[model samples]
Target: MADSVPKASLYYYPPSIWCAAVLLCLEEKGYSEEEIDKKVVDLSKGENYALSFLRLNPKATVPTLVAPLEKTLSAEVESRFKALTETKTIIEFLDKSRSAFSRTNTTSSAPAPALAPATIAFTTVSNSIIDLLHSDEAHPGAARWYNARDEATLAKICPSLQAFFAAKRDAIAASLAESEKGAIQASAKTKKFWEDKSTAASEFAQLFGDGEKPESELSPEAKAKREEYFNTAKLVWETNLRNVLTRLSKEMIGPHALGDQLSLADLHLGAWLARLVTLAGGDISDKGDVAIGKLEKHIGNGFALPKDFQWTPARRDDTSEVKPVVQSKLAAFWDAVRERPSWKKVYANGLH
Candidate 1:
């Protein structure tokens, strides 16, 4: 029998924001679950560190897509696979690969809507917005990781974070034990990989997980390191994220990132904003001032509306005037994307 063609697979974690972005794009592109395999790499258990997965994605990150190259997408030829390790790249690949006109997409009854912008101006805007959302300074995922603003919030998050660290430590220890058995132990590279991971995980657990000490109980060195981490987290939300939101409000062309048509920018922005909302302890269902208030409390800054923006006036009896409403541009964008079936499906369980 001839060698079987390799099927495409996505290695992802459920609560990952970037994974959610790719998942949302996949849904929007009209892909069924059967078309592509979904493989969950459990981050809590350090499954990403497994040698098999590491061979695919050296970075040990989720949302990795293993797909056959276009030239190799034939049964007659041996298939060559490539790992798309970045979320934005994976989304773009998914968007471009599934159009109705593509030879591989014969079953689609209608054309998949182009997610990439059609014009240069829109393309520039879309790329810029996507870059900003994924920037290190404005990273919502890191912000969520270091989110413990007050005693009340710290208490709420510590238990889960501790559990996560404990699982990671245990998993790494198991891997180390397995690495020491048999001929595999002779490979220095493999041995170092587990040892390096073990050391890093232990350091992290000490600082943020199992070895976390009370403020007064911490050594001066440990105290300073912890304080620096917390301060950096605070700075990210107060400065970088706050500024990013301001830029989004001004740059957005209303309803969507670039007018009426949904583009790649919308996919990234929607996922990024959803994460920010969740980090603020707010729900995606939150609207207007309620949403703003929750974000403000979390970021420790006022979310300013445009200067010329007017609030809807209060309703009066026997009048045709609509009831007063409060909303910002970001809130409008959130509301617009939240209505999509793609968004609903990705977040069916809850906002990550």
Candidate 2:
């Protein structure tokens, strides 16, 4: 038997999106970086076997986090970790935990929580968007709405979203500007005030993930540096999303899909495209946004949803017609992405 000491086992493929999403969730849950990284495995080339994975988890999917087996271990430790570590389970665990972590975490001392979990929330939202868009009951109006969400439509929507963020950003800037004006005469509280403000600004920086630039897009040396950075973020972000999405797409859209209800997959796709464009710092051209525009339309128009598709938004105030809890989280995550400077850059470019 293999020794399970000093580490828990995580069977994962580096390129698997679910694996990455799970990893991000773990990080959000206040797990140490060392602990989180230790469990990640890159099984991209068929290294994980069905039996081996089944021994750990019957589901046998990538991103399985298995605790180290030990003789005479207390039931509590075993039960807690075991009960809480699956992808969706872990995601929920982190959602609550990250808030707690943010309250007490002295490691960063930043205004916002470390963004390791933003990616986690991103995956969750994307999954929801994907599920909603594909369901049969998807509102007919959504199709046309999505079609309209094209670059041209975004030219309109982007302005609205941008105006919202710009005002917020400007408020922060003005407050900071006031502080700078009194920097020399600043008192202890004033100094603390400025420090707090600086931390808040950096939160936006931490939340945005920028991968390396392509060699084709840059000169050799710059490309290499950008590539390295991109590789790190991409490996952790995109690669993980790919794994999760593949499983989800096949399971949901494929022939032998999961439960009758439409799920997180559709939301994931919409959120994903939204993030991609945000990351790229541009919106799709008026017509170009068509690729993902359909999804937004479906969401906006109220999907008809299949009879069996039962996950509805949990709240009465939510505009969505799907699972409320999932929708709420997704809405928050999308709000964050849209507010980022990267989003502005992308939206500006979309005008072209």
Candidate 3:
């Protein structure tokens, strides 16, 4: 029995942003890292494609959840896995079906009032984050505003943002080779994703074909494409970045994701932002630096704070590090969320 997996458990990888969200949610529900059985799936070696993992989530994505197999389950629900895929659905499941308020949560309730049960605010903030993801992805041909310029533009920035994509691409390539060595066919999407990422990486490499060479060295067609790609990327990011940030800021209702109550909403938002901003972020210019959408620029350079901004002292357990970025209500909301005890636990030990 000691060697057997828990009847219920969370399987995830540390690098996955969504996993971080779920971990925080579990903590908020009064489940400690030690309390819930957790399985760390190593996607780097393609463990996610293993048949066993595929049984849990066909998509092969991280943060896959496994419900406790129990005899008490209703006949209709018993047959289903309750296996949750993607951060949004996983968070929703935890909030609706498994909440700290509904569970035996003595840990998180005293310091702060137990968060309001998940509400429409969860859907609202979740959707906003997805919108932000679309803007961030900007993948060629997939974006709605399909134009060659945007296509080329995203390609050009791909090189500048190589750190963001290269790690996953390389891992998939390696995983494919390993699968062949082990005589395992791997999962359905495993090979396909590797091929797609390989092509994308090669294209990004080509964009940076001549880091030291002058633009004159390229053919006229190549030069025009490069020029349009990079210039358009710069223009689009610069033009809308501030507006997008302000829009998200205004949408936050309180100190956390939806309102003052620390709900699963904050978990998803904090986990995603922390991964993009604090962990993977390297170059100050890259999108990984969640700071791009933050309000630090407005406050530091002698700019006035937003009139509606709530200026709480940034000093709280782990929140002191988050400091105050009082450019908008949204900024302050996140600032508060980061300091949350559940978030701190997720940060300290949930991953890896």
Per TM-score, the best of the predicted structures is: 1
TM-score of 3: 0.62
lDDT by residue (1-352, candidate 3, tens digit) is 2223233568998766677767777666555444456899985555675556767887777888876444433434433346777667766655554443343222233232344344575766756754564365422122111112334434444444444345545666666787778866675566676577667755544555432345668778777757765565444333343344455556666556566666655665565445433321222232211342433332123322243665456466864465543435554555566566775666664322
Assess every candidate by TM-score: 0.87, 0.32, 0.62
Instruction: Tell me the whole-model lDDT of each prediction, alpha carbons only.
Output: 0.77, 0.37, 0.53
Tens-digit lDDT track for model 2 on 96-197?
A: 434544222223222233322235655554455444433433322122112222223433433333343334344445545565786434345544544454
Error of 2 at 274 (Å): 7.2
- By TM-score, rank the candidates, best first: 1, 3, 2
Which pairs of residues collide in candidate 3?
Answer: none
Ranked candidates (lDDT, high to low): 1, 3, 2
Runs off by more than 4 Å, candidate 3: 1-6, 42-55, 69-82, 100-171, 174-182, 186-190, 205-236, 239-241, 275-307, 311-327, 348-352
Q: By the lDDT metric, which is better: model 1 or model 3? A: 1
Local accuracy of candidate 1 as per-residue lDDT tens digits, 1-352? 1236456799999998899999889888887665678999999888987778878987788899998888886787788989999989999989988886554422345447889999999888888888888899778757876786544465467677767766777786876777767523425776576678777667666666523356777789877767776787678887888888888877878668897777898888888888888888888677645665687677775546553223454567665768544467676666678889999999998888
TM-score of 2: 0.32
Off by over 4 Å in 2: 1-9, 26-32, 40-43, 67-85, 96-291, 294-335, 338-352
Q: Could you give the C-alpha RMSD of every candidate to the true structure, in order shown?
A: 3.8, 20.0, 7.9
Error of 2 at 292 (Å): 3.1
Give me the runs in candidate 1 sitting further than 4 Å from their true place: 1-6, 105-111, 183-197, 209-214, 305-326
